[model samples]
Target chain A: MSTADIAGKARAPWMALDKLGVLIALIAVAGTVLPFAVFRANRIVLGEGLQIPFALEALPALVLGVLIALGIAIALMALSPLVKLVGGFVLLGALMILIGLAATGLIPPGDSFARVSPGAGFWVLVFAFALMVTDALARLRLGPWQRITILALVGAALGSLLWAGTFDDLSILKEYANRAPAFWAEARTHLVLAFGSVAIAIVAGVPLGIVLYRIRPLRAAVLNVLNIVQTIPSIALFGLLIAPLAWVAANVPGASAIGISGIGLAPAMVALFAYSLLPIVSNTLVGLVNVPETANDAARGMGMTDRQRLMGVELPLAFPVVLTGIRIVLVQNIGLATIAALIGGGGFGVFVFQGIGQTAMDLVLLGAVPTVALAFAAAVVLDALVEMASTRERAR
Target chain B: MRAGLLIRLVVFALLVAFLVNPEAFAFVFAPLASNGQPVIYNQGSLLDLTLNHLMIVLIATTLATLVAVGLAILVTRPFGAEFLPLSRSLANVGQTFPPVAVLALAVPMLGFGTAPTLVALFLYGLLPIFENTLTGLTGLRGPVTEAARGMGMTGLQRLTRVELPLALPVILAGVRLSTVISLATATIGSTVAARTLGEVIIAGLLSGNTAFVLQGGLIVGVLAVLIYDGLSAIERTLSRRIGQRARA
Candidate 1:
């Protein structure tokens, strides 16, 4: 009914998460119950013609009822502070999330309910996140506040959904949540498979790129390898790895059973990492090469050594661009990480594969939402890092 | 454009090694499978897979070019000066988020198949095409337009005859980029039930077969990159023709 001012520009952090705001927290609690209500509450719901049931039922209710209602209330309130105007849409989105939960009925009172899986709750949040993102991305006629508030809301919606496992099946979450030790086992398994291979890629790719760049004879050779590597399909790449890695593991110490545990994560990470190398390497090469000819000349004129010029002038200037490459790689890695699920690597792919296996739309969200959200979150974080690094360079 | 002699030798060696040696093939295929499980290669039948992948990427790229080129043209009109930043930012969003997310969201509506994959690829391809097209069109000089008008060329004539000829190279580069990315991304179409080379990779992943994955990955990757390079060459050639005429 009423609007409020955001914190001062001097207090940027206070305005960020809005720690004091409860924000559909009640709905989150209700997440454990919305399934029954959704199944029960039908205004003769017309399902979306070409959608999964969860989306089919939930989107219109939220868009038509909540998003529109809020759109109108704010439409009339011209005097609403700029921050609240954006935040109002966010709150409306949060409210619609509550309705979405009820509309989808993620947490059913009984099996008799239309009985979308628990993951429906998460998808509700995902839909809200999409809504918020679309809203944020729409345009900002106002100021930094509008963009910040809208973007923050989109982030918050996505984060909360992931945190709550709203987009996934309850069975897996409950199983994982209750079976903490097994979850840990799985977690360690994934962390190792995912992080380990990616680490290997970073180590190998950077030097390889630099070496290739520096050596005239090797540049084309290495670049061709890079290009070839860039082109290899991850599926094919993974398939290619299986035989040798298996041979090594079986014959070699402690390696044979690595990917044999029902074919999930390990191979996926390997394939993903292989895919990751090109962007990192090429970007680094490009960034390094892009050094102004004059800048290099100046370093030479100043009597700097090659190493000094590289460390002092080139790497620093090129750091931003190289990091931009890394950023792209990292975000790409997150998406590819989902493919690791095909190999049983875990992360968000579990739900996706499960969805495919069970032929249930709800189960798919278990993997899909998190995969999408994780990729997006990674993109945002890397984006922020890129902005910070570039701005710092500019300041310098 | 000729590479140095030693560099050329290395390239030849790598090409020979990859095309000939079983060991070199191993490097390419090792990661595609797991547990010696024949995980990759010949995922479904070959023809269906190839067709699916090609269609998805090709359709997406074509659609993206149409929409992006149209939008770019509109925004380059005289009245569009005030909105350049906004258009640029929208294009950024096309690249900013993960394309996988776009595919996931699209899958539900379009159903799990090539349609969803096509949409994802289209959105993914949109940014590069939009920006390059915009830059190419907007980079036009006032004198060129004045000369066209003095020569009594109509608006459409000016756009199609003069501006398009000049902007073709830059625009084609964008098309090349978007096409290569779409080709790689056609792999994701598998999850949505759109057949492609991804089936081979996913199979290898499931079966733990590296060779199959490698085979598919290598073929697709080489094909995509070479195509990209070839397109780039075509762009260079076009630019040179225009460039030579301009110089004259």
Candidate 2:
């Protein structure tokens, strides 16, 4: 045989071993040897709960099948590339099966008041499997659209499982059972509080930004004031608003009629709006100022009025940057809105504060999961919109 | 500039006076005080509370800076480059999850008080420092690094004597941002039974004592501004030094 053929034959054996796959296997081994789960009663107090030790021998046939699949996957990593891909799929499938079993099967059917929460070891396994899947996908070099599609499909599958009563016995779900009706109301309040403040901030901040940009003297003063406003803690800002708003509600004609009060939604909205102003204003100014001189000249040469040039040229060019500012403000407000519950403003924060007072981890998760999910979703959507806008502009 | 500095100093002095003797500032908050209610937050010593608040912020910010900067350094290295996405997502998770939620979640594992508060603050403070550290390290001048290499400096030497010194200003900006944020957020730790200025504010809200709320807010706000200004000055000084060195 020729030298090339001989080299290819020699290299084939070493190519089978996937280094990251080995790491994943090691983590899985650690996970299997540690405490796999915690057994808790009700949603609140964790009193004298039993720690379920993980045992390979004690696992049912289905779980054992999953563990064996993981082992086989590690072995396949050193084999053919196609086999490596199969191993990845097998690991992902096993993960899903594990989650399903933990959520539904691990706890007995009659233990409605109890929860079988995944412990540190289980979490480590989940993390390792996720990392392995990500590594495999990265190796595949999938396009962004394909990656997102796969992620969405996986998310939908998990969501369906949760919706189909598979995880109804989870402690977090039990907390939801108690507040099922009010949950929708609080979610609505949260959306309103977040979006309403963003709208107000944009309305006031954009014009102020334009004015500041046009007037050199006002820029520093306005920006510095806004900077200081941003530095105030959300809680402190809410506190600061109480007196002035209370005064306005008491003294101003029709203020209380318009819902301007010391506590609850009004002050919360005001604080969020104030907190949102700096980023939007600064971004607006920056975007407007950065519009090319050539663009302005081109608009002027076309016989456009100053206002027309601004509307048609400057604003359009600046739109993406301003959108970025809005994205930051929107995501920020979602997280900040959780603090409003502390002031008796109805939102997820209500659940959070209630959970803390009651010392109920499940209730806290009930509030927290949605809040984080909403923030992440808002950020992703806004980022996608910004990307679309910029790409469209570039295409033009 | 001198006049501005004078104004800041006066403002800081007044803040310290207020913190030292909150009753002295009672008249300023008198209008917000309700009938039959005390005009000042007297249940806790304002000085002690302010110190405790600052201590919590200091500890949290320092820990966050060390961990975030260390992680950023690791991820920027060629060996750790593949973990960048993982580290980034972890930081994003911290940012997306509200500090209140962190406190609530942490309390179960860590129990009530300073430990949970510290955990929440550390997580909340991570993003700014990590982003800044990454930016600072990655944004180092190519020529400067090449010069260091040409002089036969080893990787560690180049990093310590060249890259880090040059990147100090940017990294300090992150530290400043994290510190200011922690200072403000530490107030919320009181809600979880952590000793903080927020305790006064929460108590005020519950009792309709606007004066107490104002007092707590005013102290926290002033402290934040002072810390921000102080850090900005240091950042400016560091940048100026770097500029002078470049010229040399």
Candidate 3:
């Protein structure tokens, strides 16, 4: 075979795997598992009682801590091809986190983040694997500058954690500042949930956005409902969920126990998902409209079916603009999602609400700092993804 | 164009139907729990309080326009391009920083009064106003600016007689967006005990009186958004007039 042909064949699997979400899954699982397995002690104290092989009840938190650290690690190492220096920095950073956990006896648990405790090692491996595979595919789409930006964001996130702190029930800024690591451990859950929900939002919304755009009546109808949905104040809507859902869960036998809510993550995620739809949907519609009538006509002239025209032409052409909308939605939600803590949806917001209740500013930062960083990172990543994925911008 | 108009008309009709029968509207508009509350019309009505809210929006938008346009002119002066984005970013950061948070911080220093609300409104209104002003002015091609200077115009003369006049259309558009956002945001003023129509909505949300809360929220929300639309129409008309005058 020609060398060009050989290279194409070799790269195809990796490229195909990346598209299938294998890369992010690998990152998430490996990054989550190995770190947790190696650093269980960093999660909790060897509390006063001893019955099992592990003296501390911190293993659940250790898994979560490892997953967040891995998100940082992958976000950092994803830059290795561009910077060469970041890969080493990520390892060193991970090591330092492990050491710091060893120094602090606080395992930081017994809260909502530990809700789905399926054994830290097991969950870590699975999540990291999934996250890694997904990211690998996305990595192919990102360019050098985009990779550099992600690395820089990952660095800033680490720095923010240092700056932000884990006041956990301390209520005082000074105390929270001292216990920054634990505070970050708490903040990690919120960031993960938001990221996870936004991920699902993209999976569902992006294609649906494409579908609705092509069908004029559907677009008009869906967009109108979304507009009205946007008008409802977030807390009020979330509070509204309490009465009906609580009633439904009480009566609806096998249904309530399933979904993400169980009265906790369910409503918080639903509320965030609803709030998220307006921007994503509108932006998609606006961006798709801007896709130039000429292109849509050309796609049709080529004898392409409606589906081909949407996927092969309009959606790709309109992606960057659609991303801008997603960025707005994601950024706004990161801040507003803090309200989720009020309903037992874990994240950095736990501190914001708790602090507000007690009138403690330090506690609020425990939630606020990471939230701001997460929003910033999300904004940057959306830009990178849009830039990398679109061939139209490449011609520039 | 015809389609958009038809769609807006249908939406308006639906809005009327909902307003006339809030109980039915509640199923579609308010969350399920927010039905069956009774309204006390005298204390709860927003129609009577329209002037107060409208003035707040108008005055705040005007102040925002003046500051934003002034800043836009200074930035566009021979040395503008480099500094313009920085100013734009600050305005964005201002808008993005949640008006509620800004109001909270401003309250402690400005005290329990309208002054704090004004400052918060001004800050909140800066983004759209500044962006539109900058977008409208600097985007003027070199020939346009040069022609004004050729007329023996001083820098200030160039700005008022040429740049500002030509840029008015776009700046007003920006003002419309800013004014609407500010009107909605100003409702947070109620938290600090500042007098505005928002007091009803906030009171309703905090108390769980479904009917009272719905009426108060519905009234304030409708008025704020409608006024937003009203100001937009005025902006379009004003922009058209300015453009026509400049052409003349």
Candidate 4:
């Protein structure tokens, strides 16, 4: 065959089906066929599942119609970016609304004992559509500003929906409402533990990194020690600290005054700080080491001291890499901070462990969803910062 | 040098002594326990706990490495290149997602036990292996593969004889990392009723016994460090045998 004929053959519809579309289609089929929500007599007991038809029994037929139409649209429109993006958003919005309505409709009126939760199929549908939208966004290749704007818009939309009590009927939301005050308090504590540990690590680790960079022999030894520390399981590290810290709190003067104890925030913070050190110090060292020697030479030619070179020349150039290390630490610490709840450090993990103890999955989601969101947001923001920092450096 | 060696020997001897007859060292841990509470973790033998812990980590890390490396290999092939972005994002998501959260989420679907913990550990361990294997397989120098192709080796033969051998050390580094991380992560499995070392620690936490916590922490920490060091040594030796510098 001629080249043109071959090219046309290769570009045929069936030959060029979008792979992501296939995945979405498969997930959609599974989602449509499986239960969308579960209806329970109470929060703790296993519940009966409500498939799409039963789930939509409470809502108008139009909701189910929209849901089906959106699924098909998303699957078919995968090759068209704008259509895919809009379809993904619309599908996600429809799913959320349907879930809330389904929960509201499923629950017996004035029956406080009933619980309605989004089921496996609901999650599958959400995941598929979210993936679809994310793929479309990636294809758009938006700049940093546009990406941030989208992130904010998504956040605001979710926040407003949450604030307006759109999902208050959902079991997870009911759990949240029950512990609204505690939830906020734990959210603050989670942020603090995650950010605070990294802050301390940065303050301490940067200098250590700089010192080690200057003194080559110390770098390997210090990093090795830190690496060993990093290898320790976070729980083990936290556990290991309890005895010494408890001893200090009991016997040492002014220790308890500052909240030093065996099982709580002290051990948690110390453990997180220890874990944070290796990433921060190593990345800082790498960044400083990678600073252009020509820049150093120029600084020297200007009669700049070692300290001056670090502050004015080397550190500025190295900031992005150091920030990268900080980013890794932050995302890591946010996750680790959940474990802090086990030690009484008071984070979202409180809900997690408590839920596990009570076999309350909704309560567990109350903790996990936020922790994941926080970590994901931290990763995104820091990633953008890292990008901006490097671009700025390049311009300079 | 002699003094340092002597100090090391003494420490080693003391460790052995503590292991052989731990009750003798009970006095040292006395301050950690409340009245009538045991000064050592007694829920299970320390050795068993350590072995069980290692078993969970081993299973999870091995499965993760197999799946991740397999997926990486598939994506690197021309026919599977379309999947590269999806696989990459999945790996990234796996990394960013925390093990504890995964464990908690899994509990709802899979219910409590070693099974959910295995799923969590498997997901948690995928990213490093996937990324490293991708890097190893794709980052191969062009001429080496070109030569293999020119020698008339089939695609399967070239991959097995040339590509995999060259990439083994790098892939091993990923395995080492995943294994070490899994070592720590399996401890959390105890929270989900998994028969792991974290049971001791959690029990200690619940009972307000610092001794149990200390004992559990010490064992897990030691196991992690030992495994990490052992794997590092193996990775180094493998890299040396292949005439390539170890990345670390």
Give the top-scoring candidate (DockQ). Answer: 4
Across residues B1-248, which tens digit of lDDT does each residue of candidate 3 receive?
Answer: 47755765675666566545545654443443335444442353354344566677678878988888888877777655434444554554344454545554464346665777788888778778888888888788899889888888898898888888878877877886676666665655655566665665545545554444445555555554455445555666766776553210
**Runs with alpha carbons beyond 4 Å of true place in candidate 3:** A1-212, A217-275, A292-303, A339-359, A388-392, B1-60, B79-82, B92-96, B111-117, B141-154, B192-207, B238-248
For lDDT, the strongest prediction is 4
Every candidate's TM-score, chain A alone: 0.67, 0.83, 0.55, 0.95
Model 2's CAPRI class is: medium
Q: What TM-score would you report for chain A in candidate 1?
A: 0.67
Candidate 2 per-residue C-alpha lDDT over A1-396 given as tens digits, one digit per residue, 9 for 90 to 100: 999778767886746555556667788777655555566655554633322223112474356456646554664355543455456556555655554456565566787776765566656666666666555554565554555566577668768867877657566777888889899999999999999999999999988888987898999888988989999888999989988898899999999998899998999999999999999999999999999999999899999998898789988998888999999999999989999987878899989888888887778889998998888777656766787778888887
What ranges in model 2 sit over 4 Å off? Answer: A1-34, A47-100, A106-112, A130-155, B244-248
TM-score of chain B taken alone, every candidate: 0.80, 0.94, 0.75, 0.90
Cα distance off (Å), candidate 3, residue A270: 5.2
lDDT of 2: 0.80
> Which of the CAPRI classes, incorrect, acceptable, medium or high, describes model 4?
medium
Ranking by DockQ: 4, 2, 1, 3
Q: TM-score per candidate, in order?
A: 0.70, 0.90, 0.60, 0.94
Comparing 1 and 2 on lDDT, the stronger one: 2
Question: Top TM-score: which candidate number?
Answer: 4
